[model samples]
Target chain A: MDSGKTTKEILKAKLAEGEPTPLYNPEALAKIKDNFAVWKETVVQEKDRKNWEVTPKTILGSDIPRSLLYTPIDNENLDYAKDLGFSGQEPFTRGLHANMYRGRTWTLRQLSAAGSPAEVNNRLKMLLERGATGTNLALDLATVQMFDSDEPESMGQVGTVGVPIDCVEDMEAIYKDIPIDQISASIVTHYPRNTSIIFPMYLVMAERRGIPWDKLPGSVQNDFIMESVVRSASEYIPPRDDFRVQCDNIEFIRKYVPRWNFITLNGYNLREWGTSGITEMAVAIANGVEILKDMGKRGYDPDWVGERLAFFWSPANDFFEEVARLRAVRRLWYRIMKYRFNCKNPRSMWSKCHVQTSGVSLMREEPMANVTRSAYHAMAAALGGAQSLHVDGYDEAFSIPSDVANLLALRTQQILEAETQITQVVDPLAGSFYVEALTNKIEALILDEIDEIEKMGGLVDVVDSGWLHNKASRYIQREQKMIEDGTIKIVARNYFRDPNLEMPEIWVKEYDPALAKAMMDKLARVRSQRNNEKADNTIKALIDACKKGGNVMAACVECARADVTVGEMRRAFVKAFGLWKTPIYA
Target chain B: MASKKKIRVLLAQFPLETHSRGIIAVAGMLRDAGMEVILMGNALPKQIVETAVQEYVDVIGISTYCGGELALGGDLMKAAEERGIKKRTSFLIGGIFPPKDIPKLKNIGFDGTFLSATKEEIVSCIQSAVAAKN
Candidate 1:
């Protein structure tokens, strides 16, 4: 009793009054009055100068409150293990890989293309020469997304929206000198039904070149759920048949190309639609889980399916918040796979995501500022440990990324890796008080969102009900109002003015009326040249497979061999499946 | 039955080839500002004449975004003339139709062309062009 008293006396003598430790706070309200006062001044400044009011914003990752004022007491119950897992562990609240960027740098993939595939191919070679590790393909909406170059729906549109890939010849032409075996490529299109057919063209090229199948190291944009949502809005394909296409592709990829990741659950598009980071994580997690479950029902091993399963997310302007969101996603995924899905494989839970800087944040005015925005977002993604990343060009808002802007975007990542030396440490912000607390908060929020989504009977229910669409629309509307009302200051539009700077020469693809005609002519020539009977038989077989509940990808492969264009295959399926009608909210 | 007064105009919207939503919206606004509007939901070469003849339109609006606007827009204008509506009508394009391409649109028989993202401003441009005699 005497020794205990002495020890207490010694500890008390050495300690300061109410120190509160790292994440704890025992400071009185009066003592912390300065922080509140600063916050109040900020609010007053915002309200008075900008005419904007800061609400208790309930964003995705941070659920405590949307308001800036977050007391330590708000997160008193946030668990270190149960709520926030350690970096590089299951429930990867911090990161996916153990070493993170210390072992490998984040991929700097800029969404790029122009004019013809042949023209774009030369540009891609230039990008590669200038130190791009991966090539990202942006398909023109007409040929790649809609699968038709000359349809009434596609008039005055080809190679203008994105890089136009009309046929197998175009795909082969784009990937000419670039070795697909060594580098990774990500195509930003949601037509798996189209991509599945288009993929074999590359395989055929590889076969001719003697490139082994195992050496092919690129990814197909095969996210069925993501496609279903976007196409649901666009009225592209029916939901039921969309799932059928997705599952069929999953089964096919599992059997044939073990190395190639099948689909990347595209939360980036959903995020672009205006959901918070937490909502993006939850919806994406639910999407991934639902797909895995569907694959399991189709007799696919979760381990095999999970191996090829990857994800795509968007990192916005919010720095630490975005980092926490990434961390929380990996952690929550680990838990769901282990506790919910009963997956035993350690690898099954790891989140492999390709993150892109949010394009929405890129403004048309003072567009050059977007370079800095992208660099910051890229830094957050790297710190959060993204395997691959695509930085939006400074001029992304007005036009499709110009070649000069793409070079700058690529250089942003290169500069971070080569000059910054920030990648030397794993989870560099690991034990920071603010980062830890935010990670815990983000994890809790994501789990809660996943729970809510699961109760809605998973991602399918959310899409079918137009819940995601409405949510996204609402989010967009709010952002639009904010921009219009000057609540969200978009530099030259709302806040600061650029008086002297001359508008740079906007790079635009000169109208190639011949290109559109050439595309139609190509499609017509292929139809006239290819064996019509064989093509008919192959397409008929694919339709039959869709009805008979057999693997449709095998039939799709045959369709590609028969020179079945993406439009014909998509049209045949749409004719058989009918189209998905979206709910009219107005 | 002498020729009765009827508003005749063309409408156009497209995803690619660089046509602006602002241009289409402006054209719609111009028609609402009391000119006849004949809208096309993105027609190709073969359908352009069919649309013009079917509507008996006085003017056609082609919105192009994908750099090939001049040639495609020019081709559509030619197709309209060949179909015997040449002297009776006019052609106008709006969107990223560059200033450099102004002469080309003129050479192609386009009555006038306006840049995208200026609806209220382009209203006067359209009216002035409409008021000018051949």
Candidate 2:
């Protein structure tokens, strides 16, 4: 639990000797190959023992050969002190802090669904009252896409998936009377331009409430490259335009909002899209590395850029793999930030992140069973040392979580925090033979994937080549087939087939139809009431900024204050940067 | 003749600007199974129906998350009917839709339901739909 390595100490020896050596011992790895050969030949070939055909759910070692029992031989190459260091030190394989949860508990964040701003505010208040420390705002599709509730394209889906915020007033209504600057508020959005919309609204909201813009807290998921590569949401706008907005917003936040976590790459959603944990993490890191390189080109140091960055991942049903993946990403990012990018500040090497339990792992058939599944995911995330966590509601597969279900999800985390003694020790699973070996394997897999991506130019190029999309699609297709063929199993849906089982009442409350209407009416009223000339003028300035390739955040703030709705801003952006050629069916 | 003709299927999201994750995967599955897959990223119901008529596609597969599909699926079918190609084209939908909405999807005249359908089921449905179209 000591802060073992100084940046000077680790950086001096390694950075002096050109490229950094691999974390594992080369001689020991060669010996493992020898041992594995004999074990496979003698145990299986000589004894005529047929090992069961086991299919792996993880990315690595699927179709390729794998040993049934891993041992000290497999982990002989691993160096605990050298590779892992102490938890608080460089190459933070264990965690960012030495004592971890014993020193401070992770922020308890719960996701919100679509509603009127007032309705969503009530939900946030209820969540805060229930011991939640962070508000992970989930914007409706219309809002995320920067469409107004009344837009013809957004008709049926308004306020369905998340809260619909049309302008500054709507955003102000969402946090009404809740102390805006005190708690963390993570704006969960993807499209870079749309995400920039919320930043101005948050700043303007604070300005009106007599709070400084610097006091506003929380992170934004502004990595549109990841959206393009893995999440498939990048198809909403041109990749080049998205990347430009990302750099502009991050630069703005770094200058003004010093306390805010300016940017994050949420790979959890991509896991649902069918990419494996290691692949997704590798892609996320590759995207981060590309950002570091871009910052260098723009005369910004890697130190300041890395300081404002965070990551988000999913802890899936594959318990050991998920644990290993969490451990591996930290180590990999550390190596990349320090050795590759030469980030001088020690804070830049640390990978700060939260883990969300995989919603795709939840099944609609047996809603009660999901409660247990979510608990285990939370436990895995905690043990693996996530900075924060969001447990999926038991009824998530059916609809937006009911109040009872959301409360129970919070209880799952609280029990882990209070009743369990898992928080007592740091990295409890650190030295387990299987876990250590698996962690090394995951690291190796991620490095290999990163190498492949680099060889294909970079993350942006990989996305442009359309390779990442095809890769994810292939993995998803294989996964669906495996489940169908009984290679992978879900409880009641695929395996149980309980004909007489009656599904329990899952939907405690359906989304109110009146709320969507109310949101539209509020948008109309705000437009009618606010300064039209100011809105028109500010929008033109925003369009000029976009055309001149200038930072558009300030212009956006002025527009927001003038009650320019999201829909109008969308047109201004289109007029300046042109519309993306949406993929055609034919 | 239809079996010999490499059946073309148009894949899309139900005209609301949702993420392209679900539809992208199914497009891969259909393409791998020897069907010509046209990925319409995120086209509206009318755009989907027009593409079905214009391309002379044998199948139209769309996915939605919840609630919206009930109306959008109905819109697609209605648009297809107005174009007089509703009978010739097979309509299918998929997503983590609520059970209550399943009946409404059926009422909208979709040829097949693919709520979380597996690879084999998707391929088999596409094949069956193409054969039915023939």
Candidate 3:
């Protein structure tokens, strides 16, 4: 399709579809066209702003504006069926599910944790009882990520941030009496222990409870894209070796636990680090493609693997901008699946995601104002058609959420789901001329960023060269300067003064002496009772798998069988893989 | 006309949780008051103590939006006390400080608590903390 012929042909299609094409209205088209033409002319005709001449302003992913200015003329050629398709159709830009929210509302997954497993269990029940669809578990930093509750490096840390789970017994004690199969449980753990300690503990619970394996519905977000992005360059593990470990899990999960979602591409963290929406989308799609490509070469079919794929994205403070982002993600993913991968299944084309509101946008000033901030962002996510949503607690800017603060955060989502009547339909913002235009603009911008990253050798390259980190640091610097200089006025922050309203108080969960004593005693008993021979053999097997480039999850399962703690598995990896050292910024 | 003595405050925007909004605003407030506010973004407790010692400021403030404050705060204060630095500096906390345990923080050696202090209140609190320390 030549430019001239394509324009004319697209115009005819638009008019036939009962739409106003920019070409038909010559005067209006000339205005927009002329503006662009003049912009190009001026760029070519004039000297640059700085020391030298002939420069074009570059749009770093961060330099791209948060919200694009779009118009109806932008979508003149958009076909409802081809472009903005139905909720459950090819290129599902609208939604993934057939009925969408009309069938059921998105899961209200609140981030919850406490000092002890029992406390977290109580909190989980409280959130579930208050209309939360799933339990979002945040593990204690020492226990979950590093794997040792009593490591000197982990001093002064306990269940304050998340529940402390030291053994299979702790996991069992935490979920005692709760129907695990009935509800979805979401856990956030990214250490070596996930394959070894965590995954098997849950399997054991399922097997013991007589629950069918297919009935287990939950999300395990194990992403290694960042290992290439953040760790590989630091020589934490040789790039090839990291790939081996990641591919091992993907292969293991593919064959077993067909119903479970193994890896959720966590583009949300990248977005939180100040990457632009387009960069986020570009990296996300590229990351997913990399994982799929590697797995396919390993003989796993894309058809089976795509069903297990999911995404997690951050919904920023820009309300309509976020809606446009989600729309662009769905549209672009559908295209990639259809054209790039040649996957025939519609589910392969589906883009399902979970959104957590922008933590950067929350203000410490008038901390109560965050309630309103989260409420609006939650609405944006709802309108954007998120599969699951977590609204930041109003007190999130302060400490761990007091019970009242956490309850209020839950209520924020409840109000949207129950009182607002916004959940009555799926794709609530569909058919908006402005929204469609924004979606197209976002799609274009994302493609440009993806192209730039591809040129740099993809997401892994950008991460290794410290380019992504530099980009984030530069963006954060600009935002900080703006907020500091009062260029962007934050209410109760740089602007208005409210001195009299006392900050609301929160109740911090304390370390329970009884629980700690019970844990220590339990730890001692497990140490004495578990078969030492079995544990030693499993550790050796895990190490051998690493050296042989074999699937580690199988060895991980054996480790769990021997009651090897999460900490022990972590130590084994550290011994072999080494710790990730971040770049030192001077 | 006598110029007001600058509070010379150091603000640590620690990510106890994921939220940075509160510290960003509070830092701005302190800066507006002619205080030399240093932003230590997402530092661990040890790094925070090291920064506090290096900066040699009149006051040290830490913010946590994540629920790790109690554990973070207790260790931070303990570190300060061990260094014999607790008496010389005033520590103020912002973000979601539960009111029920304000006494606990006080007992742990935080001079005053800003449960969710606005920028203005935060600045004022810094001024008073600096004065009390002097």
Candidate 4:
């Protein structure tokens, strides 16, 4: 009789035989312990006076207490093969690639978008010319909130946060001269519902340019977590329906846009929305697991969907913790894929991520210091084996980055790639005792949190029940209190508060009212000029798809070809799925 | 002697702007400061004013992280005036607007504008604005 078990499962069961051996010999460890005790009594005790207690100890975001020093004792049970595998191997704790940056550096992708599509196009061209290797398109608040430019709800907000794209025309205008096939573009559609509406426009634009869908190389942030947990908007679709749309988008993109990363499981916005790094990774991984299970139920192999799946993370100010977190999540993701999902493809197991510097860490006071902060965050991302990076601008604390600020951000990554010798080595901090121990600790903590979330009926139920929001709320308040009480020292914000210090004037990009009007006019033109009958039919089809549990992405692509606006397509989904009042406030 | 009434406040984010961390933190702070807070999620200026008028809140704090503070702030004031709560309700603006735009927000009938303000400072400012309104 066939047991019907996978090779990975069989091997995993076989490998869990007994307790692992210690890295160091017992005699050597005993000798070190004796020497350490002697040193602490003679040298350490003489210097510090009272005991070995260091006042006000530091702690990581996961509440891991830091010791004075970490030795082999801390990682005694860390088997290199099972735990920190070699780069490009099973359990790729070192890195996804063997050579890492030495083979090819991480993509210097600066997030740039603002004003109208044409204006944003200009900035995109300028950034590419100035050394940005990829395009990161951030949508405007109205677009992200799923409202047309002409809607009253979009007043004073069109093209304010990022570029506004209403229909295929706006999409074409944004990528007019830019070669869609040449460079990858990260369409920062932060929600699954919006991704279904907006990404199809990009696809249609590429088709108009005669670019095949298979040739498109980019990603859409098609994570429902953004809509449900991170971004608080006026309206929301129910979590269950949003998750359906997410899986639909993933299934469609995986089939057609073979090169495109269907979903960048977003933890950047989640962490920036006031959660710790552990929570961010746990939530994202939990979301990824739920997505895999859903897709599996849809008759798709986990490896097929997981190959193009990627992650987006925010590397914060905590240097080593961020580095260790990246390493830990990489290994943890590989473990989940290999053991839980029975994924055979190596690419499916790889936890490739794009990192953005933490926007919340930037302070408005002495804003120039934000440059240094972002640079450090960028460095941490690089050391942590990020596949791509977006160093946030100093003015991010205020408004969208001006041209100069954007250039400085680009230069930050360029400098690290060119000047710093950090990239020459793969997983530069791999063997460090402290980093390894922290990596082990963070991995365990994230897995535990993921377990807890699963116990609470998984990500969808947790989000729908507002448990995630409540957790975020508590962290938000605690972080604010810490900063306010000078516990979390932010320079110029709390610590060395200097009101009279001479500061360089940062040029904030002002919102042009004409830009909003122009967007509205263009949207009106698109509405009047397009085939309204075709648009209406496609929208109805979209509504049908949404209501009947059909592929919403296919309907969205048809709607895009028919010149349906983003807001209109979104309205179709809303009309079908109805609105869900987020359990944001208890 | 009757106890003093709690400082009733309505805290909201500008419509379409999704950054809610600051506003959420402020809601916690206001609640801790013994104020009754009616938190709204990304409401339009009209909705915010109508809610304020209906709830008869003492203070309205609008947090706008994205740009267009001048336009949104002006519209909020206009809505308050249209509802005839311009004088009775204290309007405050906070979050990541440029310092240079503080005067514009104030000129647009905002009772107070805060940029990078501490929680203590915000609570005190709200308290004083409510006191002056009374």
Candidate 5:
């Protein structure tokens, strides 16, 4: 754990007592290669003559080619101590912990939210009672986009997708009678601007509940990627300003909320926006690097900031590719932290992640099949050594999950944890020739992409210049074309044309028509009863802080105490910094 | 032999609705099919109809992912009706919607409702709808 030891030095120290030799010697590798060549010409050629090809030419859902079979010849160049180190050690490519899931099971966190705040609260309690170990909060579009529920622009969309949080009162209602201090929560504030505005309300609610800030353990998706690259909004703050605000949120959270993860580098939404898995990690890593450099400039310790940095990934249909990408990113991150940033803490080197099954992979046709698809995706996440997981509901392709669908999604994770013995060993797929080779290939590709992004002037420049938009557009179009031409086969969608399949009786969550009026009335009550002068003064201070390039989160916490609404804080930001047209729409 | 006029289409979504992959792909397909595609980024129902009328588009397509399909779609149809362009403009709705809600969209005068549709299906549907209108 010395801060000055290089990876090579650490490897030498770890292996000095008994240096391990390669399992396959040169003669053994040559013999395997010769036998493989002979088998290819004899048995494989014979099978090829009969057109009995069984193995796929490429990995599913990706362009990476795969061989018919793999052996020790594939991983002959892999170094055990450096490339595939022991779990819980330097260059952690296998698993974060030596015991892996045997020591502690991955957190079963379901992303549940819909209807009013009280309704979402009830659903959260129900999920906890049904066996979810953690809570992942999904905010309504109105709340996420920084509009109050009663605003004209928020009409008909108040509580449709997730919970509507207008003020601290809404936050209190959402976590009413729930011990947030005990159970961790993930507030999906998503973009930096919203995080600055909305996360303060959560802190204020915690304060009101007499829970200290350090005692509250949770994460916020305060990612600039959501604002710059994956966002579909037509308007945005400039990427540079958003990045600054992102660093501001990090600085404030690291100082005040010690146990809280200030930012979850959000690759999940980016992948769901139609990029490949390689681009997803590369983009997120590039963003993380930018934030680290900014915080370093602000004179913060890399190890201190790096330990709390976490990632959120979307596990898509490519099972092996997803698992390999996870392993590859962990190793790549360890190298980045150790060599590039010179961080010596093993915790700082750990690439902790929470994965959500890809919502885009689920199909609306024969929705029940989505259950199977998500289960497979969740299993891949577990095999990839995720710290937490969220299985997309079978009915999410249509709307927010119905109660039955939510329960089923939670049960999917529970079944995997209890019934399957897959988690008994650490990194069960570590020694596979195919997996190791794939991990190396993916790691190299991601590093190359990161280098390309750096050459293009980092993430902010690429986004501002519309290069990221063009890349995403091309990927989206190509994916849709493949699905259309049957190159990528989805069960009932493009592959097996089933015309007579009976549609199951799916219960979709209905939108509450009365929600708009009720929210409007509640806002009216809050406005009429609160101290208007205090709220106005806090709003002025927040706007001043925004204009002065100061930490806006502190001012936002003050605003939250004054009961300032989400929309009010957002308007103040817009008033101070204005808005930039998103390059995609521009 | 005279050249046929290219079909003009306008695709719009609500400002708060943040799912654009479907609409962007559909726009690309329509453009490739020799149709003039106008992307109205994040507009209200009234603004969408006004832009459709101003652009003289033959079709108006609304892509909604986050909820509020009924309210927004109904308002869009009403706006078009008020402008007296319902018959001239073929209206279509696409994106994630419950199967039961398809009838409601049709009831609101949406000429077509597509869910999980292929590019070929969307292009041909728009072609036929515009051809019928002509």
Candidate 6:
């Protein structure tokens, strides 16, 4: 059976047999261009005079044009096995699981957060009671920055944007009565150093309740690159050490919490912060490479780290482009994981993602219209084969979604899941003439952006040089100008101006006067009731371990159970490592 | 032609509000429209009002979102009044809010406010507010 031909040559010969006729014709495309030039002189010129300033182009966030028509003039080169394999197969451009939602529908991971543990707990319970398959919680600014609620810097910020957690008790109370083993719970935080502290609290709390570590399901949004790129840089320690703590969690979780997806590299923040779809995809990938490079230096296996990571992305208003973006990300992630990172595991190469519809696309005026926009983006996510999806509330542009709005947003997803036959098939849009072409275009743009960053010495160096921030800020400003110039028409702004624009009555969550008192009093009680001697000793040991450049998770777990506050852990960090200075560009 | 003294404006967002992109874009647009814009990045209300007094700017723009802290805007006016800059400077608020909140914001001494206003709307507001102050 041994042949003279090499395995590579054998594969080449097998693939060379009977290729389909090219699906495109250059002569036909050229003929269209010639006709388009004439139409531009006559029909388009007449239209341009009236609409030129309204929108510079009918384009997707990837900068792909919206032509008057699409007829696949150059899609002849699409190979099925090469470009897209079947769901759950090699080079998984379709879906991660073979069954997709057919096995189980996409998880409705509605994000619920507020000031106090009890308050957020109520919201989470409500979400689960109302049919949410998973729940995500956003920590307040104080907790995100590693501050205790009683700190002066945390004044008036306790439990504002997300839930507030000051001590182990707060974490316990946040999940009180909700069985952690049953429902998927995700804690959305920026810095991994914070995750280093917060995850220990979750693990210790789960352990105390008799739940096995592997049984606790969900992810921690512990990506630090986007924190530097889009979020306030002041919120994190410098990239190098922030990533150090990120790997610490990776090493610990691989050994202990094997079932938990420890990292959700969040490009949703960047996209919501104003970068386009291609940039978001590239930046998220670049962020992962940077983290893996750091982990490699520390001797963590690339495949082990890659397999455990997940992604969070936001698709904007472009329907087909959003669908194409989801497809392109899977293909791009596969190439990166296998070729660049040397990942052999098929699961390691799969890009499992949780998608959120863009909140920035929501309009404040005539807020009800946002419901329609959200439905379209949700349809795109379903058509794009998201593993899980969170549809934005119609009232998100103003405040956190009210009870009514939150319910309606969840209902939107339910209707799509139940009413439509979307989840019945994997990669529903695959093999389409327009969708396939757009997917290729997006994949090309992502590589181009990645190449540009690689030329700049990668993400960490570009951020160190302040280039990433400048690009994001400038793009957002330019987009604003476009909207103002009547080029990018926003609904109810430049496009639809309702004559009777009566502001609809919306239920606003009143700022609880007692919420701050409640948070501070809890922190005070924990500080007093804990074994002060053990707490102090544990904190000291944790800081010393960090200074010694050891994996601090074990010590962190020890300190967490001893009831050391987030403030103490953070204070120890700043004492050992000075604050990072963010590069400022005018 | 004498270089006219550019209309000076000061802007800031509430402390801990990382939604600074909106204010940053507004600051850039205002500067591009030929006004001298001073951006005080996320700061406390007192720090913002104090900067307005110290800088002697023509307008004080405060960005409030994430539940649109209406009370914080009122506190800002009170702080500005204590510093004796409330009457001298025009106060404005910008955020995503219901149209119903505009009158309340005005009642709290905000000469004007923007609920996702256009660049043209923002620039014109800055121009007219400065002209009125003069």
lDDT of the structure predicted as candidate 4 = 0.85
Question: Can you write out model 5's per-residue Cα lDDT over A260-369, one digit (the tens) per residue?
Answer: 99999998998888688888998999898888888988999889999999999999887888899999999988888876677878899888999999998888778989
- State the C-alpha RMSD over the true interface residues for candidate 4, after superposing those residues: 1.7
Docking quality class, candidate 5 = medium
lDDT per residue for candidate 6 within A28-93, as digits (tens), equals 767866785676678765666454333123212656764443454546566677778888887788
Pairs that clash in candidate 5: none
lDDT scores of the candidates, listed in order = 0.67, 0.76, 0.67, 0.85, 0.84, 0.77
Model 5 chain B poorest ten-residue lDDT run: B1-10
What TM-score does each prediction get for chain A alone? 0.85, 0.89, 0.84, 0.93, 0.92, 0.88
Report lDDT (Cα) of residue A429, candidate 6: 85
Q: For residues A1-586, what per-residue lDDT tens digits would candidate 2 score against the true structure?
A: 0123332234345645644445557787788778877877777664343552343654221232245666677666455565778888877898899889989988777786557778889988887897777787888877777778887677677777788888888778888888878988888866578767777888888888899988888888888754455433322456667677777788788888888887787677666666788777878887787777777777788998898799988887878777888898888788878777777887898888878898878886768899998998899999889988889999877677887888899899999999998999998898787788888778777777887887777777777666776677678767766666777767887778677766564563334567778877887788888888888999999999888977877788888888788889878887887666433321
Q: Per-residue lDDT tens digits of candidate 4, residues A97-197?
A: 99999899998777777777888899889878966667889898889988998888888777777888898989999999998898889888989999999
The candidate with the higher lDDT, 3 or 6, is 6
Docking quality tier of model 2? acceptable
For candidate 2, list the clashing residue pairs, or say none: A114-A162, A114-A163
Off-target runs (Cα >4 Å) in candidate 4 are A1-15, A18-21, A41-43, A46-60, A499-505, B1-3
Q: For candidate 5, what is the DockQ?
A: 0.60
Two-chain DockQ for model 6? 0.37
Docking level for model 4? medium
How would you encode candidate 2's per-residue C-alpha lDDT over B4-117 as one tens digit per residue?
A: 888888887754545556676677677778889887666678888888888889899887675577767778888999999988888888866666666778888887786555
Per-residue error for A290 in candidate 1, Å, reads: 1.4
Scored by TM against the true chain B, the candidates give 0.76, 0.92, 0.86, 0.94, 0.94, 0.90
DockQ of each: 0.16, 0.42, 0.16, 0.72, 0.60, 0.37
How well does candidate 1 reproduce the true complex, by DockQ? 0.16
- Candidate 2 accuracy as TM-score: 0.89
What value does the lDDT take at residue A581 in candidate 6? 62
- Provide the lowest-lDDT 10-residue window in model 6 chain B: B63-72
